[model samples]
Target: MRMLRYCSLLALVAALAACSSVPGGGPVSQTKGEYKVGNPYKVAGKVYVPKADPHYVAEGMASWYGPKFHGRKTANGETFNMNALTAAHTTLPMPSYVRVTNLENGRNLILKVNDRGPFVGDRLIDVSRRSAQLLGFEKQGVTRVRVEAVPGPNARPATVFARNTPAPATSPVEQKKAPIVVASARPAPVFTPEPAKKDEVVVQPLEAEPDSPATASENIYVQIGAFSDKLRAKMVADDIRHVGQTLLELVDINGQKLYRVRIGPLPSKARADETLGRALAWGHNTARIVLD
Candidate 1:
């Protein structure tokens, strides 16, 4: 009788473990499928990001990402742990909080925006697997969402005042607008670059001697703006020249006139990086490290 009772207890424990939720933890993760979906932010041309806006709402597609980017670091220095409740937005002040609601089901979840993106059309929000699951989109991967900026303590504080409440009206014009379509959800290829051709030669060089001091190499040149008009290119060139004791070079690429803005002919890549960092730290995203 003692042996039989022990076996029964063991079976019960195994059954309970089989029913667990998170990937290896429970059956829900396995039954629902892994999170390998990617949400890319699609932006057309350039965008003007506002400093701070209290209320912002965008009616567009929502998507999720998971698995592949699991341990990678985000642009804001946070780990991309897909299991966690987090998200990515094009621009919302790094680490700002948001509330995402599934318009269809009315399900809601809050997430921290640590990275930037979702460059597709007017799509507003990009969420993680856990957040997506909680918002009730686990199976579908992507869903129609209404994303709203959740006010934080540091945000502007004001009082609520009553205004003329407009009645909810369903007009033919409103109904005629086509519904936003959420694309297929899948993980984005982050580390992968363009593939090499079959005839491409692979060079394996001996490692540099550890004791030898590193020598200075070629200067990295990044082109800020390449324009057809030579005069317009000079205008941007003049704006960035004084920032760093940097020089600007104008070169014609193809047949079009091009103006290339350079940060260095500096002593080394470190000095170049230091100079580049300073410009960006002072709010210069347009400046990029151009490598030949």
Candidate 2:
């Protein structure tokens, strides 16, 4: 009876050992899928405050990460997959959803923001390889995009203010049209070149005849830098001149004069996007598309 009891105890111990041994001897990490409002986290000396409710909208350059980071743990404890439609954002809550729109090609998709990253310059979000492919920016490595949060099911409705009462309607005769007045033409302004200081580059504006009514359309430019001093703006323009034809324009914003360095009056949005990607690669990370 003692021998039989010893054999039974040994068998029970073997069974317990078998149950505890995982396939590869590595413990599996539990993935947290619930929404979490994380505390303020600092990366590269910048503090990012995570928002509990999804109410964020921003536009900037985006980049993607691939095989090097595959299978690693994400910010929310989930396994990272390069093939998954997931992304990493700095300030949005973990395990949240966002709608990313590629401003260049107009291709848009929804992706889960499950990680944190892209601590590089001025990049708004870092998406997975699969997400980049879907957004049509995989080959270029970077593109300008607009990101907005998609509210979850339990999200509260946005507050709406009541509209003011409308004014009383008037009869057609009471709203008679006013007489049209003809305006006089003014003399064209003279163009004078500004004096340049030593070691300062001066970029002249391109001359063109007055545009006809049939050819009128808004021109778009990629603004790389704006500075209060023309010499500083010229220095930046000289540094980035190899990217494309660089131009300088004087702009007034909020009563402050600024010299803006721009890339082009790019013909189309697609071309502008391609140039934007190249600019980012050349270290002009904060370059952005502007409509004039």
Best by lDDT: 2
**What TM-score would you give candidate 1 relative to the actual structure?**
0.37
**Pairs with backbone N, CA or C atoms under 3 Å apart (clashes), candidate 2:** none
**What lDDT would candidate 2 get against the real structure?**
0.64
Off by over 4 Å in 1: 1-50, 153-292
Q: Report lDDT (CA) for all predictions.
A: 0.50, 0.64
The digit string of per-residue lDDT tens for model 1 on 94-210 reads 565566667766555556667667777666778888667556677897889876676531222111100121222553224332221212322321222233233221111211222
**What lDDT does model 1 reach?**
0.50
The per-residue C-alpha lDDT of model 1 at residue 202 equals 17
